[model samples]
Target: MADNDLEIFLTARNVLVELRLNLAKAVSAGYKKGETETAVKSLIEVQQAIDVIDHASEELEELDEAEHDED
Candidate 1:
C-alpha cells in the first residue's frame, strides 16, 4: 500500500456512502414522478451523485495503481 492509500480509500468510501444516502433520500422525497416539486431537487442531488461517484472512482483507481506499482 502507498502512503496515502488509506486516505484515498476512506475518501472513496465516504463519497459512496453519501451517494447512496442522497439517492435514497431523493427517492423517498418523491423525486420519481414529474408532478412533484421535489423532482428538481432530486435531479440536482442525482447530478451531484454523478460527480461524487466519479471522484470516488478516481480515488480508488489511484489507490489501485499505487498498490500494483509496489508489487
Candidate 2:
C-alpha cells in the first residue's frame, strides 16, 4: 500500500477508536449518574459517527476501484 493510503486508513481507524472511547465514557458517566436518557442520547451520537465512518469507507472503496479502472 502507498504511504498516502496508509495514512488515510490510519486516520479513519483513529476516528473510529476515538468515537468508541467517547461513547463508552459517556455511557459510564450516565450510569454513574443514574441518567438513562443521557446514555441513550450519547448512543445516538455514537451511531451517527459509525454511519459517517461507514459511508466514508464505502466512498474510499469506490475511489480505489475507479483508480484501478483508470490503470
Candidate 3:
C-alpha cells in the first residue's frame, strides 16, 4: 500500500474507535436517563458502523495481501 493510503486507513480506524467509545458512553447515559428507546437506536447504529468498518478493514487487508502476492 502507498504511504498515504496507509495513513488514511490508520486515521479512519482511530476515528472509528473513538466514535464507538463515545457512542457506548451515550448509550450508558441514555439508559441512566431512562431513555431506553433512544439508547437502543443508538446502539444499533453503533453496531452497524462497527460492522462496516470491520468489513472495510478486512477488504483492505485482502487487497494488501494480493499486492504482496504480485511481487
Q: Output the number of the lDDT-best candidate.
A: 3
Error of 2 at 47 (Å): 0.3
TM-scores for all predictions: 0.49, 0.57, 0.61
Q: Count the backbone clashes (under 3 Å) in each candidate.
A: 0, 0, 0
Candidate 2, residue 42: how far the Cα is off, in Å: 0.5
Order by TM-score, highest first: 3, 2, 1
> Candidate 2 residues 31-64, lDDT tens each?
5554656666776776677677667777777887
* Candidate 3 Cα misplacement greater than 4 A, ranges: 1-3, 6-10, 30-34
Backbone clashes in candidate 1 total 0
* Residue pairs with clashing backbones, model 1: none
How high is the lDDT of residue 60 in model 2?
72
Pairing residues by index, what is the TM-score of model 2?
0.57
Question: What value of lDDT does candidate 1 attain over all alpha carbons?
Answer: 0.65
Question: 2 or 3: which has the higher TM-score?
Answer: 3
Could you tell me the lDDT of residue 12 within candidate 1? 66
- Ranked candidates, highest lDDT first: 3, 2, 1
